[model samples]
Target chain A: MSVTLDQARKIIRQTMAKGEDMKLKPLSVVVLDAGGHVVAFERSDDASPGRFGIAHGKAYGAVMLGMAGTAQMKRAEDQAYFMAAVNGVFGGHVVPVPGGVLLRNAAGKVVGAVGVTGDSSDNDATAAMAGIEAAALVGEI
Target chain B: MSVTLDQARKIIRQTMAKGEDMKLKPLSVVVLDAGGHVVAFERSDDASPGRFGIAHGKAYGAVMLGMAGTAQMKRAEDQAYFMAAVNGVFGGHVVPVPGGVLLRNAAGKVVGAVGVTGDSSDNDATAAMAGIEAAALVGEI
Candidate 1:
């Protein structure tokens, strides 16, 4: 099954909590179901408006790749034209960064994804893992 | 203000219930806040992949119109060039159809819009109304 709204909210909440605990910058988080339709999204009060789109694009790209998002960076570097075309197909919602992670269910099946934005890409990825693990789901970080 | 994630999910849940009750086809639904930012979206397991974009477009069109979307159909017919240009401005995320309905609060303020896709436009409109009503909000259908 794809990510449910409740699960998506939990991921957002836990991501926010992790960001606070880590003293990261104000963050925006997005969770997309397996099919890449947004299930839920939230941005910390101080986050810039652009954070939302960035977070969403990261998750959308990761979900479409069916893999961790950091790998996208290497692809973008090695195959610039391919990455550019893929971004066009997704309306530019693909971010080649470390902030995107996959959400998997008990059977090790990717059911959705969590993307975070605000601080460094590494910090964002850490926050994403924190949230996914806290929600009792597997994180393919 | 704008629609909350909780309210958006409630609308989707109720919309799915209504569709199931009426035995309509598997559906995809979208909820966009007043600013036309997507807040929440969902689709049945078997829904076609294109449903997500269709639902999103319908909701985006209605939210931008800030009025009942059926009026959009008339405008599109009367001023085809303008409608086409407007759609281009929105990156082509506009569906001039009955399934798009604006959401209002108790004060009759436009807060958001909900769009549905799967069945016929009339049935989709019916489902949209059911969702808006169940959420205890007003539907500007």
Candidate 2:
């Protein structure tokens, strides 16, 4: 599956707008290709500078690991050893947070991921999900 | 400027070893290329899974923007608009945290970056610097 630049841009715009409507503070959003390379990113003016990195990592981790950072975090609680081994193997690029939403095609194959930061983790996840749905895509596991 | 997979792996190994000697909890480390692409990553067995993404984003943002995410956070205090514009433009992958260390050559050209998480930002930065220096590379601004 492929994610177009246009689609990524649209996701950013729509997500930002949703953030505005929610009266959330500044935000950072990122979209990644299936290969986990960045396709696009945006940071709101009021967002903390660190928000961008956090958001990007969340998104990239989702794409690379095929799960949300939140979910990964939960699993880490029980499988600390495995998580540590994977982290060492991957060099710490995979995060399991809710803020990351996987993009899936109609056939349900993972295509890409969207990640957001700069608000509560829940809000960030919500915004990313909004963007993915806005792009006419589904957010899967 | 480039950070090869071998150098990145070495950095992670050295950093982890140091962490172990110090009896520090598990850590997550990431190396990024000049283009902010992941070259290598690792998560210590005891580290949180989320640290992986956080570390990767921090490192990528440092390399992409030529500064630490913590410094970027400081800049955001005064330049909210500029920061926001950047967030919008980059789609949220830029972080200005202290854990990010830019890799440079003697010629002072940025080659890549290293980011560490699962510890204080300051400790993460320190470990990253040690790794860079161990690789016989320069880390700066």
Candidate 3:
């Protein structure tokens, strides 16, 4: 299944709402299609310049590797070279930390991914998961 | 036949040999499958580090745009601002210049591409074409 631009925007909006409800810090969010192409992205005014890349790279890496950010983080600890090669091949911007979650359709196929940054990785991941659930989709974080 | 590791290495070897026979500058080459994933890459000792990235990016751009290197170059001239946005959003390293040649199968399906650098764009394109031909593959140069 493919993610439409409207669906991507909805993900971003819901993600931001979750962040606000949790009283998290200023957040940056990015949504990507199955092909790892950006569909929509937004960052609060207080977010730093690096936030965009962090959020984008996180989602991109998740989509490309077919792994959630939390899964990647677990792998990163024992598989140093694997993560190194991943980042190296992908232009060194792949954030293998938490806060990136995959959106799965009812068939369990990965449709897209969402990434959030600017807060703790756990909180960011929580917000991303909530957004995906709120959008009437399943989360594979 | 499908593009395999053997095919990728053959493309790289032929591309480098063509550059050598033509007395071109130290050349770097990259072979990417249709998925835009790197299959193989090699650079001459004298080639700069950036050569690898240039060739990779050029080939990646061509694959993503579904255009040969020359085709992208022509488009770039007419769509300067469009390409500007492409490179800007794509981490600022997409090379729209010539030298990446798409490989087509007997059925006219794009199987992969080879990117060459370290010489003039035209000559690089020529070397890329030669490599594709030597591999018994047709190219959309």
Candidate 4:
């Protein structure tokens, strides 16, 4: 089954809470359904102005590529120009970053993604993974 | 008070439910914070391709102009060039349409906006207003 709206928003909120617990900077989090449509999103009160778009882009990229954001980053590292062109084709929804993770339901079927921004890439990934765990969803970070 | 992530998503989901109840087309809905930053967004599985951007534009226009989408449309009607320029300056975030409405909190202070797209303009406004009401927020349709 696909990720529900409540589940999506819960992932976002839980991820931001994890960031807070780690004393990390405020974060923006986004969740996208398998179809590449936004299901839920939030920006911490102190998050930077552009964090929402960045987080959403990262999530969109993960769902679009059917891989973790870090994996996409690795793929883009060798072909930045190609990746940029790809993003252009999708109206800049693709982000080669480390904070996006693929999410799966209990049955291990990919369902959606969670993206976090505003901390170090490693920390962002950690938070996103934590959110997935909190939701009892499998995650590829 | 600001619109919480839960409230934002609830607004979107309820608006889509309203659309379904009315036998309207599939819809896309968006919610923006007082600062015009997106808080939540959703697109029905069968919604039109560009409905997401259109929905977001409508909400952004309502929040940025401090008026309902219909009012903005009226103002823009007499100054098409000016409206176009405004949208250009904002990177096309403004939409002078009838589907956006301002949301006010308990204190009657404008807190954010909700926008809906899919059916005719009047139907869109009706759906958006219903969502705001469901969220217990005041709305100007």
- Whose TM-score is greatest here? 4
Predicted candidate 3: what Cα RMSD to the true structure? 14.4
**Candidate 4 — which residues are off by over 4 angstroms?**
A1-7, A20-24, A76-92, A104-111, A133-137, B1-10, B13-27, B45-49, B76-81, B105-109, B134-136
Taking the tens digit of each residue's C-alpha lDDT, what string does model 3 give over A1-141? Answer: 667778777778888999999999989999888878888999998888889999997887788666788888986785443355345446776789898888788887778889899899999998888778767788777
* Models sorted by TM-score, best on top: 4, 1, 3, 2
Better of 1 and 3 by TM-score: 1
Q: lDDT score, residue B28, model 2?
A: 89
- lDDT of model 2 at residue B138? 86
Q: lDDT for model 3, on a 0 to 1 scale?
A: 0.79
- Model 4 chain B poorest 10 in a row by lDDT: B43-52
Query: What is candidate 1's CA lDDT for residue B23?
Result: 99
What is candidate 1's DockQ?
0.22
lDDT of 2 by residue, B102-134 (tens): 888788777788888777777777777778878
| CAPRI class assigned to model 3 | incorrect
lDDT of 4 by residue, A11-110 (tens): 8778888998999998888888877777666777667667778987888888888888888888899888988998988898788789988999978788
For residue B125, model 3's alpha carbon misses the true position, in angstroms, by: 35
Which regions in candidate 1 have their CA more than 4 angstroms from the true location?
A1-52, A73-91, A104-112, A118-127, A130-137
TM-score of chain A of 2: 0.90
Between candidates 1 and 4, which one is better according to TM-score? 4
Listed in order, the DockQ scores are: 0.22, 0.03, 0.03, 0.40
lDDT of 4 by residue, B1-141 (tens): 577777886788789889999999988888888988887777776665466679888889888888888888888998889889988888988989899889899898989998888999899999988888888888888
